[model samples]
Every structure is written in C-alpha cells, then in structure tokens.
Target: MRQRVQIEGRQLEVSNLDKVLFPEVGFTKAQVIDYYVRIAPVLLPHVAQRPVTFTRWPSGVDGQAFFEKNSARHAPEWVRSVTVPSPGSSRGRETLDMVLLSAVPDLAWSANLAALEVHVPQWQVDGAGVAQLPDLLVLDLDPGPGTGVVECAEVAHRLRDQLVADGLDPVVKTSGSKGLQVYAPIECADREHPSRYAKALAQELTRQTPEEVVWRMEKALRPGKVLVDWSQNNTAKTTVAPYSLRARPLATVSTPLRWAEVDALRGGADPESVRFRTDDVLTRVAEHGDLFDVADRTRAVLPAV
Candidate 1:
C-alpha cells in the first residue's frame, strides 16, 4: 500500500511501512527511509553530482536483489541521468546512463524501492557534463581466510604510515562488511590522473610489506594477509560511501573513523565499536558529525607518482 508522506516539504509516496527489510533486527522499510532522510545532509555531499549504482532489495534483502543504474521513467523532474563513456571497457566502448542522485528526495525514493545500498564512483559529473577526474584515492583492504578486520586494522596502521610518508592524509573507515577502506583526498584538475598514482602507491605498499599486505586477488596469496585492492581506484569503481547501510545480517553501516579510534582497536576495543547500524549512525551524526569531514574535497595535491 502506498501512502503520501511529507519529507522536507516534498510530497512522496512511501510504501511498505510495516515490511521488515532487516529481519534480524526487526528493521522495517519505513525505518530505512527515515535513516536516509536523516543522513541525507551528510550523505548527499559525498554523492551529489555523481552517478550512482543502486542495490535494490524490493522484497526485503532475502527475497530478491538487483542492481540498477538507470533513472526510472517516473522519476521526478528534479532527478536526472547522465550517460558517460564506460571506463576501461573493452567491448566496443560501452556507455552507461546512470542515475545522478542530487537530492535528498532521491534517497527517499530509492529507499521506497528497497534500495539499501548506494555506490558512487570517485569522480563526479560537472555542470559541463564531463566526468571530472577523481580527487580521492581509495585503498580497499580485504582480509584473507582465517583473518578478519583485526588483520585489516593491523594492515591499516601500516598503510596509514605509508600514506602519510607519501604526503597524503589518510582517512580510515569500516567497509561495513569485513574490511577497511582508506581514502586519500587530493586535488584532481591539472594534476596526474588518480589511477596512475593510486596504482603506484598500492604497488609500492605491497612491495614494502609483502607479508602484511598483498595486491593480487589470488586466494592463495590472501591467506593470513590483507589484500590491498588497488583496482578499486579505476574510474568505474566505488567504495561503500560512509554511513550508507549494508544489507548484511546485522544491517551494518559503512562508518568513518578517527585515527584514534583506529588505534583503539589495538587497545582491545571491539571492531564492532565502529560497526554502526541505521539508528546508531543517526545518533552518531547528531553527536560527532560526519567522520569524513577531514577527507572530503581536500585540496592537497599528490607529490608525484
């Protein structure tokens, strides 16, 4: 059943208020909408002007799931789509017209479709309709078999030092799953492309700490080590945005972390300390504000590849 509701003075038809989307936590579809609505102020800036690939769970997460990139025909006039050349595609240069999520209402609308996960590339579409070069370099750390976020945290400390050595300020975050994502924000225009520098940095790190980290996806190389997935730096990829909810059984949110919090994990703090859920994220935003404030839109430039 569809019901009209007012969100920031915009009338939206929100349905399935009582539907349990996260059965483990008894979280409902309405709660998901509320979470997005509340987190939009911080969430929108990271996603604004960027094309988004949405993970939709129409029948709750367990029933059915699909990823959607195109804007719906019934989408509001304020909502728009942009077609861009696929990055590094070999199949005759494919193009994808992705939904440009520019407004808070867009979040609510997608939440209505049970789109719980929002993924955005590092680059954003400018007013000129050109895809700007990525200002952020992300290093994805995936733990190997028998290892978990603890190994990720240990690897993250090493990565943080290396990133700092390279003169890039590192911001850390939980991937809302089992890994950690470290992002270094830098100036993009008129500088070297981020992919070159990102790949180089990742490669250098692997060389510097072969035992602690590996860059390859080979499962054998991953055992007892954290995989520094540098491939995510490509123009086509996206890390889970901070504060976005994950469809995991615990309904965890990808959360930003202070360097101190990252260090605290070594002091016996639970990795779950940083694992935020929808409600916990709201309270956190109210109390501490966006943990990503340090890494967003940084004007610092990378020294050289």
Candidate 2:
C-alpha cells in the first residue's frame, strides 16, 4: 500500500507501510516512518551536512539486507544528494552519489524504502560539495565472544577518562548492536589526525589492560576482550548514525547516552537496559532532549599521545 503525504511542504509517496521490518516485536514500516519523522527534530541536525549510506532490509530484520551508497536514479528531485570520492569502491566507480537526509520528508522517503539503518562518515560535505576533513574522532568498542555491552561500557569509561585528560570532551553511545562507540569533537587540519589519535589511545589502553582490551580487528585475537576499533575513523569508513535503527530482532536504536548511563552499565546494569526500542527512544528524547548535540558544535585539536 502507498499513501501520499506532505511533510515540510514536500509531498512523498510512502509504500508498504504495513510490512514488518522488525519481526521480533512486529514493528512495521509505518512505525519506522513514524519514528524517523518524530525524531527528526533532533536527528536531522546530526544528519544535515553528512552523506548517508543506507542499509535497506526490504524483507524484514531476519531477511536479506543490502547497503546502498548511491541514491537511486529515480529518487525525487527534492531529495538532496552529494557526490563524494570513493577510492575503495568495488564497482570501480570514482565517486558515490549519496543521499543527504536534511529534512523530515527525506527521512520518510528512506524509511518507505525499508532503510533500516543509516550510516554516515565522521566528516561532511561542504557547501561546494567537497568532503571536508573529519570534525570528530570515534572509537568503536566492540565486545567479542564471552563479552557484552557491560564490557564495552567499562572500556568506554577508560577511554573517556583518557580523552578528558587530553583536553577533549568525548561522548558515549550504543552501537545499537553488541558494542558502544565513543566520539569526540576535534578540530584537525588534515584527514589523518583523528585516526592517528584514536590508534594511539587504543594502543595505550590495550597496553594498560591487556586482559580486557584489544585494538586489533582480527577476530581470533578478540575473544573475551573489547576491541577498540579505531579504524572507523578512516575517511572511507562510516559509523552508524546516532538514533538510526539497527537491523536487530527488536529494532534497537543507536541511541546516545549520558555518561551516567554508561556508568550504570559499567556498574553491572542489565545489558537489556541499554537496548532501546522505537517507542522507548521516543520517550527518551521527550524526557532528556538530544544528548549528543554538543559533539556537533564543540571542537578541540588532537593532543600528542
């Protein structure tokens, strides 16, 4: 089923509203559209200047999913887009035409297409359509087998303290999957500063606590440890955008957190406590407002390790 809706004066045709996107909770495509629209006030600011790469799961969470970096050729003219260089494209294409979801209508369009996850790079495109240097640094803490969100949270606290010592203010968020991602705003002159800073800190943490932290990406080396994935800072890599839905069984969101919440997780709070569903997140926004808006405006230069 398709229905024409007008949002911010932009009309869109949303389809298959009744189709289930999260099978475990029976969350439907219509609910997904509603979540995106209602969350737009806070979400759009974070998404505005960034190029979005959508993870579409037309067949629901348990079914097949595919990543789409290039916006569809048939996309509406009103849908904003930007072309960015893709040196690692397997298709041998020099660039990708990515969607820039700046408004509620753009999000509704993506949700209609079953885009369950929204991913964006640390850097954003400038007014001239040029990809700028990264304005933020990220450390993706992923727990391996025999580990979970609690372990990741513990590691996040360690990382956060170190970031504070270095004079940068870092924030925490759930990956909306099996980990926590810590991000800090940084004013860097070039592309390599963020990645280099993250690698140094990850290595430092690994050295200080070899029993709990691992910086490498190799799966075999990660058992019983939280991998501080510094590689997501790469220009080619994209992290799941804050507040984007995960393609999980329960439709968890990549929700931002107050450090107090991370502290609770470290103090043995239930892992399920961090897993927020669509409705839960809406309530959270209503209560707390955007916890991550500071990261977008605050900036500090990387300090030598």
Candidate 3:
C-alpha cells in the first residue's frame, strides 16, 4: 500500500498512489506527489519557515476529509516544525506544534495524506520561537452565485489599483476555485499590524466600488459582488499557499496570474484564460518562471495610519 520514494537524496513514504483523487480527471496520489515535486522550486519559498495546515482526503477528494495542524506525529523527524499558540488559546498561553515544509521530501510525504489543499499563515517563526510579523497581506475575493471569475477579475483590478496607490505592489492569483486572492507584501515601521491595515483597506475599496465589491461577509450582500475577505490577514488566519492544489473536482491549482491575464479577462477573455491545472502550471513555470516573485518584495512600505 505504501512505497519508499527516493528523491534527490531524501526518502519518503508514498502510499495509496494509485488511488483516485479527482475522479472526473482520473488524477491520482502519484500525480499529486509529482505536482508538488515539480512545483517545489516555486512553492518552497512561500511556505518555508511557516507553519502548515493540511486538508486531508485520505480516501479521495470526494470521500470524507479532515484537517491536520500538527504534523510531528506523522512527519519525519528531519522535517522542520514549530509550535505556536493556537488562535486564542487562553490568551495565547497554549500552543500547538506543526511541521514547516521547506523541501521536496516534506511536500511529497504530505501528498501521501491526500492533502489536496495546504494553507499557511502569513507569519514566519523565528529560531527564537517567536511568530514574526506578517510579510504578506492576502485579500480573498470570493464570488457568490450569479457571478463568476470575470466579476472577480474586475474587482481584483480595482483592488490592485487601490493597493498600488497605497505604495504596495500586489499579486493576483486564481483561488483554484471560483474565486481570486490578492497578496501584497507590506513593510512599514509606522504600522506593525496586518489585520487592521488590511481591514481598513478592504472597507475603503468596497466604498469605492460598492456595486461590485462587498467587504462584509453577509450572504445577502454577495449576489453581484466579490467578497473582499480581509479577515484572511488576521494573525491566526490562513490562506492557501501559492502553488497549492485546490480540492476541486477538476484538479485545478491555485495559480499565480500575471496582471495582464486578469486585465485580459476583464476585457472579454474566456474563463479558462486564468484557470490552470497541473500540467499547465508546470509548463507555466518552465516558460515564465515564478510569477509570484513579488511576494518577497519589501521595498514598498504601507502608508502610516
């Protein structure tokens, strides 16, 4: 049921590799591991030194699923892990230890769990065991019924414009679902908080385009608008790390999009213009390199509150 895979010099246990994950596409566990192996060059940078959360589908994507936060029990001893206080664990006194994926073996082993979706917090843990400040602020743009990625694309453009005006460079990506997420790297000594700044920006952006953007999470307000989920920037919150494969029936990936692609969609491009699958993503990296390299940008500072 399980096999030891030797990659480079490290070894990993890959099990249930023939099991189908995406029934419609016949995607299997083997493919999942391969995807991670191929995407590691681009993904490791984003996930390195950050705590990881796993959404496991042991049987398959259509089967029952569970989330795993602590990986030490299942992870190899060589894997790097850190424990941080749970979101509000009695005022942060309690803590939970988790694996930090920094290499190919870490990812391949995680793939064995059918972890189709991987999420990570914005903060990185320092060797001193402190959770450092968030370097990236993410805004999740989720579409409601009657709207599509097209609408989300438009909203993303407007959001990007607003962020640029604020002196920050933001990158847009398909959520690998029917939504989009924008990641902006912010660095400013004047503001040490991420949640407050992200929330204020989302609310302000909603005010500028009330008809198409909804900052509140109320369902009734989402019909024709993209929900600007600023809450993802909270310290305890997590967003799907870039290059993560979404647990979709279609085996889609949370792909980084060049601003031109988003602009094209808003200008009448087809829906698949931004949608990418495993093969498509590998090819993309081969040609364009890592498009999300801006995620490490530290030059643009957030405006003081």
TM-score for all models, in order of appearance: 0.91, 0.97, 0.94
- Best-performing candidate as measured by lDDT: 2
CA RMSD of each candidate after superposition: 2.3, 1.3, 2.0
Residue lDDT tens for model 2, 186-278: 888688888888999999999999999999989999999999999999888889999999999988999999999999987888889999988
Q: What is the lDDT of candidate 2?
A: 0.89
Superior by lDDT: candidate 2 or candidate 3: 2
Clashing pairs in 3: none
Clashing pairs in 2: none
Q: Which residues of candidate 3, in runs, are more than 4 Å off?
A: 89-93, 188-192, 295-298
Better of 2 and 3 by TM-score: 2
**Candidate 3 C-alpha RMSD relative to the actual structure:** 2.0
* Residue 202, model 2, lDDT: 94
Task: Single out the weakest 10-residue window by summed lDDT for candidate 2.
Answer: 291-300
